[model samples]
Target: MTDEMNNAQEWQARAESAEAALSRVQAEVDARLIRAELKAEALRAGMVDLDGLKLLDTEDLRLTEAGDVADAPALLARLKRAKPWLFGVAMSSSSAANPPRPEPPRTRHANDLSHEEWLAARAVLLRRR
Candidate 1:
């Protein structure tokens, strides 16, 4: 009976140890996944350095997790407000994916005048004649 009790206690201890180890692994995995998500968001917002992006506070973490982050500009602005040091350097943003087509150059000649202007000028010339 005594041996059986000791064996049961040992089994219980091992089980508790395993449970603790599993919980730790789970926490680590969750933390990594959160970092990955934030990194992805940062990259989408044109942030170059994944290392530079750190979840600021519990509210920030919750906001990211809840998918309540703002658009790219607002997100960048919020991050700048939170971590001004991170934005201290001049980070280069990519040019718009497709820049608007350049307007075609005007084809009108330098002396080109509107119809009204031309008519008025002709009237003045006739008066001079």
Candidate 2:
């Protein structure tokens, strides 16, 4: 009876430890998933810096059954409104609203010169000196 009791207690302790470890792993995984979701949402919203995520209050955020942040878009929108400096200018879907600027023709520079061109220029410069 004594041996049986000791064996049962030992098994219980092992089971408890296993449960604790499993909970820790689950918490870590959930944290990682939440971070990933927030990052994706932030990128989509044109967040200039990822560090802006640290400013967010995650206490109110809930996780969906799919393991995604439920109020992620809303949370990001609030953050963007609160701290507009953290995000870049929002891109418009229609190019008609803002047309692309035309670029002027690029002038040739010393860096653009080939070996032969460089030698000729060097010769001309040396003669002028």
Candidate 3:
């Protein structure tokens, strides 16, 4: 009930509020640091987009950091299992830089075998396999 005791209680409340704010700010800073670290790791592993890792959840990021994942490729493999949208339809590196080789057209030979011979040859191939 004393004035000094009342002031002491108010100060204690103020200290707790400050501590909570500090903890919140620290958490935000730590999150930013983690995102930056993940981006660096992705770049080192030759990933094209570091921001993709930034889109991952905290738990996913924590698991990546804790798991036996070796590089961004491995991390991406796991993330793809959960978020297939991260990667659009897969494409072989046959982009315009290295145009895709046109597949050779299949054709019957000039000295073609009859159906019976072809059947026998197919059976032989299957057995060989």
Candidate 4:
């Protein structure tokens, strides 16, 4: 029937709209992440030496150019021998930057005192004044 055909077209339109919205949101997220990385890099400059050991991000550890993995073990051995934290700055910065996780939602219990009970408690304090 024509009615069924119209309903199918409407559903298809809605699906296309949803996909477009998702793409826009993903683009925005990518832009934000790029900005954060740039800011972090600027903050790290001058303080670390790129020649001796490539500065990563927050912590001090160098990485080999061949692969993404940090040359942490060699750096750690050096740190153990030097014990440079005594001076204030730790020599190397961490190569990996971790994104923050979203916070969990708060929970409420019905057995907990209702909103009316809170108002009553406030009233009792006002009466004493």
Candidate 5:
């Protein structure tokens, strides 16, 4: 009877320890899943950088049994709304209010320059040298 009692207690201790370890591992895995979900949603929302995720409040975030975040997309959307600079610039359907300025004209090369123009340019360049 004494031996049996001791054996039962030993088994109980071992089981408790195993349960504790399992819980720790499970929590770690859930945290990783949450992070992955957040990243996926942030990417879909056009986050400029993953670092911006750190700014989000994750205390309200919860994981579903399937390892998916319950409101990751919504959370990301809220974050985007609060911090527009954290995401990629949104394109407009209409053209820019100010049209792009035309590129400056190309510089005329010596070979393309008229004889008189070349002579004038040559004198200027020579003076600079």
Candidate 6:
């Protein structure tokens, strides 16, 4: 009877140890998740525009290889002072507005042309406008 009680006590101690280890692991995971959530919230709050295309620093203005004005805020401020129309385009394409969608292909009548002809027609259509 004493031996059985000792074995049961040993098992209970092992179970408690495992539970404590699991709790420690869970706490670490929870902390990491909380940090990640906070970072995401900070980014969202600090976001000046949607695509993150505009930088927080405005003084660094230059044209990128992709032709986008690099120092967007300064460029925007300049445009606001100079050309409102150009500024509007920049603002519309920035994170503050939904991105411009590519224009859909113009459809041609299937009955008027064969498949190969339609493909060739589409290529010509795409090039023309």
Off by over 4 Å in 3: 59-77, 80-129
lDDT of 1 by residue, 1-129 (tens): 999999999999999999999999976766666566666766666565556664444233433455444343465568867666654456458755666799998775436988887788889989998
Where does candidate 6 stray beyond 4 Å?
Answer: 47-129
> TM-scores of all models?
0.49, 0.70, 0.49, 0.36, 0.70, 0.36
Residue 126, candidate 4: how far off, in angstroms? 56
RMSD (CA, Å), candidate 5 to true, equals 6.3
Residues 1-129, model 2: lDDT tens digits: 999999999999999999999999988888888999999999999999999999987766767998889989989999999999999986768757666689988887999999999999999999999
Q: Answer with 1 or 4, whichever has the higher TM-score.
A: 1
lDDT (10s digit) by residue, model 5, range 27-118: 88877888889999999999989999999877677898787899788888888889999999987889558876899987877889899999
Candidate 6 per-residue lDDT, tens place, 1-129, comes to 999999999999999999999999976665555444433433433433333323223333344566344444443454345533322233334466566889998776878889899899889989999
Error of 2 at 34 (Å): 0.1
Per-residue CA lDDT of model 3 for 1-129, tens digit only, reads 699999999999999999999999977766666666666665654456556786666554432444333354566667667666655565767666766699998787636989888888889989998
Sum up the clashes in candidate 4. 6
Candidate 4 accuracy as lDDT: 0.52
Q: Model 4 TM-score?
A: 0.36
Against the hidden true structure, what lDDT does model 1 obtain? 0.65
What's the CA error at residue 92 for candidate 6, in Å? 11
State the C-alpha lDDT per candidate.
Answer: 0.65, 0.91, 0.67, 0.52, 0.89, 0.55
Which wins on TM-score, candidate 1 or candidate 6?
A: 1
